[model samples]
Target: MKYPTFEDVKKARETLKDVSTSHWVQDDLFTWKWWLLLAATFLPWVIWIKYRDKERTLEILCYGLLWAILASATDVIGGESLLWGYPDKLLPMVPPLFPADISVIPVSYMFIYQYTNTLKRYLVFSLLLSGFFSYIVEPIFIKLEMFALHNWAHTYSFIGFFILSLIPYYLIKKLTIKK
Candidate 1:
């Protein structure tokens, strides 16, 4: 019931760091999952860059950046709360699923935003995309042992992703200059 001293906290942190390093070396590094994560980290950005609307590049990028920030923050909260976690990491450090949070999610959402010119289309795409992520994508990650859900369910993810998509869309809609 007593608060731990800073020294104790440091010791715990060091222990975790050592364990993460060892686990990465023995189980995570150079594995097929790691290679897949590497590809996932870069490939979407490449495709997004090539196919994105050239005229609205900056506006679209702003939307993507907002999504990245929100996704990364939510990932951290989920991991910290033991709602979900990543088993295979590209690195031994924290924010284990950088590819999904920083690259894939944002880039994919950005495409949806750029392509959907109307609110109705955006909502429909958002709902479908959220379902795809929560049901199909998450199940695959669970099967692959890349992601684990301790106290969360696909329905929660579905709702969360759908709302996350709409937030950026609506905000960007207001922020973008009228033409």
Candidate 2:
């Protein structure tokens, strides 16, 4: 078995450094959409901090990370398929996935999971959240030219959002119930 050495990591970093400088087709910064991306990235942390004491912090964070990874997974496919895209990014240095996918969306799911305890409540809130993301949040980005839909529609988004929303909730429920 072979493991990468320290020098290998440094060389990899140097090779990828050009990404921050010019790898992307567009790196719109300080624009309105850029500002919104920044807000989307940090606002969730603020919201989470304000309500920190109400839930199991570790479990909630785990759920949030799960949602982030799920979002990233689907996001990679969507980006590759050209169904949708983010034109304005908060950080071009990172993967093209939105920062808010990791922060805002997942944190929002964590809150929903904490509040809605029953499967019935979970279903209701999940649908509401799915609609909120598909109809409201996605549209805001579409209007701002941050997210563009090519072959995608809000209908497709509702399906994805609804499924993704419930995943963390059920996962956490199963995990904590055993303990």
Candidate 3:
């Protein structure tokens, strides 16, 4: 059997435009959780856009993308490993709530970087803040039935997330410094 090339795949998709308007609407409705998650995830970016200086916005966007990728990777791993699960009501997918884990967490890191230029300081604040949000705030989500933890225990996972946040903080500091 032969695999389709990118162009072939695109052509196939274009030719197979059998999607109905009702199906599109249903898909949109099904993805409402994703939309809400996106809004919540982007709230930090919106705030940053309003309050942040123009010079730093690009830098923050870069860092946000980096952290978002990392967070998404972690979410994929965690979900595949049965570490945690999100409610069907809260998300259309498993583990991550419409990429919120990736996007939101990274933006939060960008906020820390914006305020604190030093790696040590950023790491400290990032760990504390992420820890608080992951441990205290997120457990409430678990309790409220928004999500469920499978194999991953919250105590260690919370600490792990705090440490994980430091990685990007240190990396950003190193990359941003002038030689």
Candidate 4:
């Protein structure tokens, strides 16, 4: 029933950090996942170049960073909890949450946010994208062995990703006037 103090949380994070960093660098350096990771790495910049002048810098920053933080946190918790995992990693120097969390999810949501003007439109588009990721892309990743689902499924991803994409839009609205 007791909550962890800041020091308790910090100590736990430090331990997890050391363990995860060691395992990643020593056991998972520069392999095939790294190559896929390299591609995942460049993909956001490519998308950014395409949309660079389309939106204000502050809008882009808030939208992208909020999603990135949420996605990374969830992916880490999911993986560390053994609910699911990205057994094949892209970046060995860091945590294994970046390929989708840092790159795909945020960028994908940013695109959805950029185009849609109304909540109705955003929700519809987000639902479609959620289905695409859950049903299409995730299954493809499963086939390619890029992703794994132990106790999780694409259906869960469908629901989770949809909510993930949608919540930030309203949050951003509350925070700013799209500037």
Say which candidate scores most in TM-score: 1
CA lDDT scores, all candidates in order: 0.94, 0.80, 0.68, 0.79
Best by lDDT: 1
Candidate 4 deviation (Cα RMSD): 4.3
Tell me the alpha-carbon RMSD of every candidate: 1.1, 5.7, 6.3, 4.3
Query: Where's the lowest-lDDT run of ten residues in candidate 2?
Result: 18-27
Candidate 3, 108: how far from true, in Å?
A: 1.2
Summarize candidate 1's per-residue lDDT along 82-146 as a digit string, tens digits. 99988889989858988999899999999999998899998999999999999999999999999
Give the CA lDDT, 0 to 100, for residue 25 in model 4.
76
Task: Report how far off residue 136 is in candidate 2 (Å).
Answer: 1.8
lDDT of 3 by residue, 79-148 (tens): 7688886653233323445446655677677778788866678778877877777788679878765568
Residue-level lDDT of model 2, residues 1-179, one tens digit each, is 89999999999888766665463445666766677677878888898978964548888788889999999888888977999987666777665557777887888877877787688987898899889989998898788767899999999999999988778777877888863
Better model by TM-score: candidate 2 vs candidate 3: 2
Give every collision pair in model 1. Answer: none
Would you give me the overall lDDT of model 1?
Answer: 0.94
lDDT of 4 by residue, 1-179 (tens): 99999999999989977876777677567877667777886788687767764647678768888999988888888887887776566654455758778887788878888888799999999999899988998888878777788898888889899888867887898888635
Model 2 misplacement above 4 A: 1-27
lDDT of 2 at 98: 70
* Alpha-carbon lDDT of model 2: 0.80
TM-score for all models, in order of appearance: 0.97, 0.81, 0.72, 0.79
